[model samples]
Target chain A: MKKQRFDYGYILTLLISLVVALLIGAGILALTGHNPLVAYRALLGGAFSNARHIGDMLEYAMVLCLCGLACDIGSRVGIFNVGGEGQLLLGAIFAAQIGVWLKALSPWLAIPAAALGAMIVGGFYAWIPGVLKVKLKVNEVITTIMLNTVAVFLCQFLAKGPWKNTNKNIVAGTGNLPGSFWLKKLVPGSNLSTAIIAAAVITFLVWYILQKTSKGYEMRLTGDNPRFAKYAGMKTERIVLITMVISGMMCGLVGMFRVYGAEHIYKSTVSNEYYFEGLMVAMIAQYAPLPTIVISLIFAILKIGAMGMETAAGVPKQLYLIIQTIVIFCMAAETGIRAAIARNRERRAAKQDVKARKEGGNEHA
Target chain B: MHNNIWSTIFDPGTFSQMLRSATPVALAALGGLMTEHAGIMNIGMDGMILMGAFVAAVGSYFCASAAMGILAAMLFGILIGLFFALFTVKLKSDEFIIGCALNTFALGVTAFLSREIFGLSGTSGYAVPSLPNVTIPLIDRIPFVGKVLSGHSIFVYVTWLLVFLMWLFVYRTPMGLWIRASGESPETLRTVGKNPERMKWIASILCGVFCGLAGAHLSLGYLNGSFVEGMSASRGYIAFACVIFAAANPPRAYIAALMFGFFDALGLRLQSYVSSDLTGTIPYLITIIMMVYVVVSRQKRRERLAKQQLQRLEP
Candidate 1:
């Protein structure tokens, strides 16, 4: 059970799994009477073809990066906050409410106000499960999952009922926030916003907090060995609460990106898949903040590319989910693959020892 | 309208709605109990149910048979069960993470296939042959009982039977002991020349099958030949919570699911007075509160036991 160095063999296995997944996707397309190559070409072209496509993909990446980081932080503290969807939705709800309420403010003031409002809401939402988990030993997983439905329903109620836009059609959502409250464009003529820049900064800040600070050390210690941390005089309960709240707040920020930066409305139709997809990106990245950014970027391509494939090549956008599933299955089985390799090495070593003894005995005799 | 919600609960119509709503959850809870007793919590029930919902519809839509749809769902359920078993039980991966991944995968794959095959994002009505409601002649003649129980799809009756069967299987049978033993002490089972891992695999697959039927019930029996994105919704998770609430006991789980259903039916009725969206939050809020109560009571019991142990030491 000694720790082995980074195993290239495991990486090879992951590569093979990816190939298998791609081949399966291709085969299915072919069986359904579509050319896989053509479909993939269209996907890539649509996701990366022009400035607009690039901007859209980046926007997705930014949101995913933040959400992934949220889940990653929670995991580090051994809390499975599967209710990221709920937290994200709550953040969006707050952002929309606050953004509209303070529409008269300058862009800088309104932007921070909306984002801060979202973070606080998301944090408080997550705190419920965290407090329950620490004090009463409630399974955070179930509580989080249940809370997700609760969050969405609440968002829907607010969007469609009280806060619903009378100016807009029958769709259940608030009117767009004033244009002044919108996050400034990263490029003046493009769809891209400073949100990506904000996301990047937040990721770095999270990384710094997780790796460098004393608080991060305590949190990681609590996650690695709660009993040990407790014995060492650390307040494990407080750590758990802090980690979960921060994770939820990060999710809230991602919601703000969509509501205040991109969509500019409190719509219940926000992609519920973002929470899961963000978690998937984090899983692929092995939960490192920097690598999370890269994986999220890759995931954004898959997401946007699939939509493009749907429009141009008549392939379903959901094919990417299959690919993502395969990736998860492959990654989740990494330990098994590692164990197999380790066993093979031990068996060969034993065989070599037997042969060496035989030769030594013969020579000595 | 507020009074109407209470009135609806007392009426047979609401009872029918409650039973219908509870059927899928009860079915899935039976499966969830297996995994819970086997030492693995099956969160992937959501995905399995989704897969079952999609595949069952595909089977019926193509073959024009309700039975074929259920069979198709069960088969796909087995496949998902195998994969879940392989990753969690066999590979030693985190069960919760794998379950979450499976749910996402199910949503993605089903959405993809639905769009490709049916060219619809949501609500393909009667894409397959709908299951017929069976009215028992004798039972239909009984006043209130008849109105409440009769004229239900076959799954409704099947769920009632499944609860009893599951209860017997988990509590009475030797296999049931082994499954429970696996969760309690897999090492002890191993010492007795039994493979605890194998037991877990069986329980997981059975859980898959149960959730599959639950999903089938949603598409064919409840909604009757409709396919939509997220049609399974949060029922799988709700069933999971029922398992926790019931402590993996079939009868308790059944009752718990009924309560969940009762709330759902009440919420639907109450929606007439309140915002439909607001009422939708009722079931989730109630579930969370139920969990909180269970956890707090459990902690209190543990504390009492600890106090007793300390008193013994002092004496």
Candidate 2:
């Protein structure tokens, strides 16, 4: 069988699907008595209108991109590490706990230490499912999901009990960590912090590792075919373990930044959408590291724009989620579109061959 | 150890509470087990349950009839199942992504619709009727087993009946064999002229009906006809775990669901003595620990077998 060419047919299908989704969205707007055009304009304007809004979008993009990279690695290796949320939460909890506990250390050391600590915890958390899957034939999907529930409960337990913000002056959350360990603000008016740079750097590094390293090649091979890799004498189980660990660590790093840059405390009020959004980003990019960054940023822009849409056009702010879901659905359905494209190409090839045979017959006559 | 604690465990009142608590999850697990048996991984059982609850509440509110509410819930459940099947089977979508999409979509759409239809209260069920508990005549007066088995909603009894039904369906039926064959050897089944997709669809629709009933039980029986955001919580996933632990056996899955229900009840009781926060974590913590233990022991067993095989090869 010939390889399917990356062609325009699939892109056309994606475009068509997106248009249909947008039309459905417009119908929803009309039913709600909101002007679709106005909402669309406001959403677009809000996403890019001001520097601060752009910064928020960037902030959202940065964390999303980082998590997307982690997810991309897992997906490429066929691991489907759906435990990104759990890993992120565990990382955040660890970072906050360490930051709050270690009062003696200087800010620089403490911050890095907290981040590193979270990475380790997150990595270990992921490794459990990976090990279970490899050694015992337990399904990772089930394990990761169970682990996510565990992580949510753990976070809830810690925030309300041991780490209880104690001040009682605010809503339930953990007590504030040292102020000095907070990420340095990158822009004067915006919440943009040095963490964005850190996240971007991490994304780049992931791209490099996947494209340049021998281990990355082996990991990809393991994802593509474990039996084949085993026949080639690769330690497939170890690769699975390591791949999950790295995926978990990346998620932890995203959590580390969220704690340090945006929230500045371990709060249970963290968004539940991050994990799904990260998965969406990775999947939309077809599990490519670099493209993940772009897709995540685009999603961030939509989120920021959603505020404008709500305020000016009277559209609900949750419109961003609908748009995100539509985009992902279209992207995920690309496989079927590609198959159609292949069939089309095959038919076209057969027609051309028939014409060539007819021309050869004419020449013989 | 104390008299009160002992009473809580062995008393008829406690047993009744446990059965009532276990009913919804057991019902949902029965549905999930059917899907798993047919080789379709369904993570959207929670979404189906949530929709069922909402629809049941809406139907009961307008019609003021419990039967109407149940019928409405089943219809909604079947529709959602079709929605899931469309993506997974027809569109060739990844089951995991589609499941996640369905979950998020249900969350948003239900919340959005509840606001529009029921007003902006974030929940509704004002003046809605609830399921009346059915007490067995003579059995209600009997001791432990009577309390454990007698007083429950019609749905609860139905759930218990389903355990037997599912067992029979899985073990004693030709269709059950086909489902197992589809999961284990779809190609073989296809060669014998069976449509595996059709089996999966049947499994999905059945799962949907059960999950819908689970939701109905939650809103109508447990919460007294109220629908709230994410009210199903992680019960669907917990039921899914029960399916795993029970190895998809109906009777075993029922037992596992009961174990979860027991912990849920214990957590509720503990809430009064300890911080409500710590108490709330109990169910989730138990689930995790249970899964981890199950996974670890299974691994150890495999390792031991591998070791034994190696030792035999050494001769």
Candidate 3:
């Protein structure tokens, strides 16, 4: 087996894309009459001004990391789980319900029950598409997309109806979990909590599974070539199903963390397309676990800091989203761009050779 | 009670609403069918529609002409199509990833530009010109049928003509054959001296144009020139589903979209009895079931074919 070489090309492409996207963002800001420099400065300052801001960024990163991992694991198993948002929502609702129902129990029992409940709900939700894909050959992407809309509506209905908080101040959500169920905050007045440590541990486990385990090897092999894996006596179907469930469970865990560590309640707006952003992170990282974590942190910074830019520089927070999409577009075009460059160089070299040979022939004549 | 429920669900108003709602989906699906036949999965139709809607609203707001607004939307749609082609066709990037990115881009840019141009309210507030309703003279004189068919935005009639034209183009035109061949066998198309890539680009452009019309109808006709955030609302995806369910056939895709429209209309009517939140899921739930039904029937057909082959071999 060949040792894996450090990918300088990918990093270079990523850096170039980042710069191009930022420049485009600046151009957009200029068009909108905002001072780009001041906006960017405000963005960076907002993300890193104090311990509280840093903590908030980290908290966002934790949620993004788990969501990215969810996507990464699905891609690794040759499944595109576009329903991560749906699974996360389902997991969140379950976690909140468990938290509320188990209010009388000790934190140890309540937390575990809540976490398990979320995992089961998310995993079960994912398993349907997985089975459909493996058994019926139904496209998971379409099913997942449809399921996402259904899940959103279901969650909203529950929040607005049966489980709605009766408190006049609370509008569209379940009541907050008991204090005992809350995760210990890492920074006072910030959303950061002990959940970050759990997230880190989960990330490490995902890395270990993907890089160090035989099962992970089989999964990757199946993803790369199902026919070859099947000929080699591996049950590719089971691997796909298991990987999908695990991915869904990770998403569910993110939902649990958001409830216990951040939001402390289940609301219709519990997640603001965090899974979609996380999917983008996973895509940019090429579906790798470690890079997903790194990219998640960067995305978290952009998200958190965008608010500051909005307040301080008077630029819309949506500007960062535009920047992020531009970056993705550039990244997607990286291979094509490199290929074009190589083609141009080859054409030039051929022309040079022709010219040199013609000159040599003239001299001989 | 049953008779009243049936009467409510099957009213002329329901049919009119169905036609109105189905118009955009049908248009998008027809465009999606073009890309589907050319072997490109253009999931970014939603984003394209969103961009078109925003641009059309803005254009009408400024020019005070629905025609100019549609023209602007079509132009912008072509640009978006080229952008999509540059990535998916020229750059050979993953179509799914590019499509998702386009969606995110559309959502962000539209939201940002709407805020910047229209202020924080993000609405043109009835200042924009809407597409006028057209009453077919003879049809308007008819009874129940007239009520269902007449007095719609001009695009509704235009969509009906386009659907028929699209069917003719796909089944009767050489360019359609080339596009189909491009998706099915690019090498064969190349052997015949036709550029499959160019056909793909043409399909992308056509898809963009149709989606542009769909968006124009949505904002100007359906909603009275009002642009809402994410108003496309996965209708593009539903359109793509329509294309798949109909096997990329234009008329069939329109029928599939009509099915969605019918359910959506029914959901609206059912809102009286059921909660609006639950009713909203009806269309999406039906789409999922339709997709599953398609897959299951296909599987059964394959199984029957295999059984037939086994019997022939034994004999």
The prediction achieving the highest lDDT against the true structure is 3
The true-versus-predicted C-alpha distance at residue B63 of model 2, in Å, is 3.4
Worst 10 residues of 3 chain B by lDDT: B119-128
- Stretches of candidate 2 off by over 4 Å are A1-14, A311-315, A337-365, B1-5, B9-13, B285-315
Tell me the deviation in Å of residue A276 in model 2.
Answer: 2.2
Query: Which residue pairs of candidate 1 clash?
Result: none
After best superposition, candidate 2 residue A214: deviation in angstroms? 1.5
Please give the ranking of all candidate structures by lDDT, highest first, separated by commas. 3, 1, 2
Stronger candidate by DockQ (2 vs 3): 3
- First chain TM-score in every candidate? 0.89, 0.88, 0.92
The Cα RMSD of model 3 versus the native structure comes to 4.2
Against the native complex, each candidate's DockQ, computed on alpha carbons, is 0.72, 0.32, 0.72
Docking verdict class for candidate 2? acceptable
- Where is the poorest 10-residue window by lDDT in model 1 chain B? B118-127
Give all candidates' CA lDDT scores: 0.84, 0.79, 0.89
- Tens-place lDDT per residue, model 3, B208-265, is 9888889988889999888988889989989988988898999999899999999999
Best TM-score goes to which candidate? 3
Higher lDDT: candidate 1 or 3? 3
